[model samples]
Target: MLNLGTVLAFGALVLFGGWAVAAGVATRSLSAVNAVFLSYVASLTLVGGYVLSVRRPISGTGTDVAFALLSGAFLAIGSISFYAALERGSVAIVSAIAALYFVVPVVVGVLYFEADLSTANVAGIGLAIVAVVLIAS
Candidate 1:
């Protein structure tokens, strides 16, 4: 049996990334604060339905709760800043630069969390940075 979970996740990311760029551009006409609020309201409404439909437990240990809250804070901050950046910068450049954020966690994981780093992983990280720099410049 083919698993649709992974496939759908990737598909959603691509679709939503495109939507984000377009939404940013559309929101560019408004002040960053106004745009962020509007986006948040829309997102919250949509997610409310999603939350209701998705059956999941919220129970977790202190560590897990802390991690979840931290992740949510960073995500909210990142999204708000990204929308603000889109108002002042080209969507292509801003999105490309923001996309490189994964590297931060990779470095953190390797340095503190005992994440295994093979030569290929290191090389890919280096190459990814170069690619983003080239694209941004």
Candidate 2:
């Protein structure tokens, strides 16, 4: 049976599939900083509303807070760089190169989290890397 987490993950995938296109199109009409700031505003409002509605506890340990802050920092850096690239470069190549961001999580999962992956998972990652290289080049 498909769980809520699985379903939400798939939904996120669908939503994100159009993100590069949206960014590319928007950057054509808007400055990169303006586009990114507008996105941040929307994301903050939506996510903040959802959290408030859920009434979920947001408190965490110091380590957890530090990690969250660090994650946000990295996200800000990446998003700014990506939107800037989109403003000046081909969306396809920029998005292709940005897709390599997943490698960080995969490596962290395997090393720190000790996540196990099947042979197929490994092959898929390898193929994704090759595809990005081919696409970007």
Candidate 3:
């Protein structure tokens, strides 16, 4: 049976794939900066709702909190930059490159965290590289 994490991962894959397409469609007539602005407005509205409904304390060490904040800043920068790329590029190619974002964490995990570089994992990353190359052609 699939675990909750697996189920959630699949759900996210579908949801974000659809979101990417929608983002590209929405960007068709928008300026890159304007697209970023519209997206932030929508995102902030949801963040506000979640903040209002929070019931549990946000628990983390100072270092952990700093890392989280830093990561969030990178996420915003990447998301806004992606929207800018979508405004000027084909969704197919831009999304393919964006999908490779997974590689960063995987590589870092292997190098910094001593995460296992199993054959299967390496092969999967190789396949992803191939997919991106094919998508670009």
Give the TM-score comparing model 3 with the true structure, all chains together.
Answer: 0.92
Residue 130 lDDT, candidate 2, scale 0-100: 96
Instruction: Tell me which residue pairs clash in candidate 1.
Output: none
**44-129 per-residue lDDT for model 1 (tens digits):** 89988898889776788999999999998897888778888888888878888888888999989989999999999989989988
In model 3, which residue pairs have backbone atoms overlapping below 3 Å? none
lDDT of 2 by residue, 1-137 (tens): 99999999999877876888898998998998899999899989999999999999979999999999999999888888999999999999998889888888889999999999899989999999999989988
Model 1 ranges with Cα > 4 A deviation: 1-5
- Once superposed on the true structure, which residue ranges of model 2 sit more than 4 Å away at CA? 116-119
Whose TM-score is greatest here?
3
Question: 1 or 3, which is superior by TM-score?
Answer: 3
Candidate 3 lDDT, tens digit per residue, 76-127?
8998889989988999999999999999999899899999988998999999
**What lDDT is reached at residue 64 by model 3?**
98
Error of 1 at 89 (Å): 1.0
Task: Write the candidate numbers in order of decreasing lDDT.
Answer: 2, 3, 1
What are the lDDT figures for the candidates, one per model?
Answer: 0.83, 0.91, 0.90
- Candidate with maximal lDDT: 2
Q: After superposition, how far is residue 68 of candidate 2 from its true place, in Å?
A: 1.0
- Among residues 3 or more apart in sequence or in different chains, the pairs in candidate 2 whose N, CA or C atoms overlap within 3 Å are none
Candidate 3 lDDT (Cα, 0 to 1): 0.90
